[model samples]
Target: MKGMDVCFSGLLTRAKHLADAGENRSDLAFSLQESAFSMLVEVAERAMAHCDKKELLLGGGVACSKILQEKCRIMCEERGAQMFVPANEFLVDNAAMIAWQGVLEKRKANKNYDEWQPNPQWRTDEVKVDWR
Candidate 1:
């Protein structure tokens, strides 16, 4: 996990704990959320530049955070870039999404099927995927 991811996770856990404790700290909750958003925006900016991609696509479970979504929007606006997010149903963990991505990967490989486990350590940038 990246530094931003760790920070965001910690903030989110703290926020959830506070919310569950029946402590109505809207201001604090919002602040924590904003911090998480800031971390994501920073990570996204660095990632986009590293990949030389004018537009960055954020996917998976974390993309559903409304705060993060807004942050990403603002960050992209500042840079005159764009961010793409998949539908909510597709963002979370689902067999269809996994199978779909696997099919695309298999197509790229252009080889026969072979049983394999989905790598828990899969790194997006390290994978050979031809999204274009």
Candidate 2:
């Protein structure tokens, strides 16, 4: 997410060029996956160091990749930390997390999503936390 934000469109363009140059699709995919996984691990390591933490928990759909899991595990091992990746089924589905957030909002009577508007300029610490 650093250094020009590394857009996915750029990766797609690169893959297109590679495909045009007669590169095999599997190799192109492998290259893109490696590039993405490396960037993710780099950011994760920086965050772990900043927080002085020794544990890394990966989630989301990409977390289901065995290559990404192996890369994260290696990074954690080299840093003497622990990397926790749940089963593939748990990695991709976030319905429970969304439901938990709903529960929290319900507890605080903050269920009116229609009243909310997007504010891209707002910073994390500046946001209101009435639901808490």
Candidate 3:
């Protein structure tokens, strides 16, 4: 997590420098996004290797980026793994996914729905998969 913070900080610093140098906003944005997405893919690859997992699922708003999708696809192909990315509409935060996941979990067993408060800033790793 600390490494991720540092990586993002570096991207922000680079972006600032580029902006101050009068670089095109689009170029700066793309550069930062590419760097950040590259880091994300690297970490994902490591996680897959560590867990011996052959499937990769990319979601969230960042997954909508064509560049990220392509990079992840190539990475998965190189590793002989399957990569799943939802459609653009589902790539971002959507209630449908959340509701579907909740329904699936509910079907497994009785979960403490009362304890599941909505968290706008929730991170995927932060959620405890008690059903699992």
Which candidate ranks first by lDDT, i.e. highest? 2
- On residues 1-132, what C-alpha lDDT tens digit does candidate 2 reach at each position? 553233466787889998999999999998988888898898889889989999999999789988999999999999999999888777676778768965776678755777656554455466565785
Q: Global lDDT for candidate 1?
A: 0.75
Candidate 3: tens digits of C-alpha lDDT, residues 19-98: 99999999898888877888898888888998999999998887888898899999999999999987888777677777
Model 2 gets an lDDT of 0.81
Angstrom error at residue 6, model 2:
4.9
lDDT, candidate 3, at 24: 96
The candidate that wins on TM-score is: 2
| RMSD, every candidate, angstroms | 7.8, 6.0, 7.5
- List the global CA lDDT of all models: 0.75, 0.81, 0.81
TM-scores, all candidates, are 0.53, 0.65, 0.63
Q: Which segments of model 2 are wrong by more than 4 Å?
A: 1-6, 93-132
Residue pairs of candidate 2 with colliding backbone atoms: none
Tell me the RMSD of model 2 versus the true structure.
Answer: 6.0
| Ranking, TM-score, top scorer first | 2, 3, 1
Write one digit per residue (lDDT tens) for candidate 1, span 10-108: 566777888888867887677876776677789888877787777978787878887788888988898889889888987875667778987887777
- Compared with the true structure, model 1 gives a TM-score of 0.53
Name the lDDT value of residue 38 in candidate 1: 77
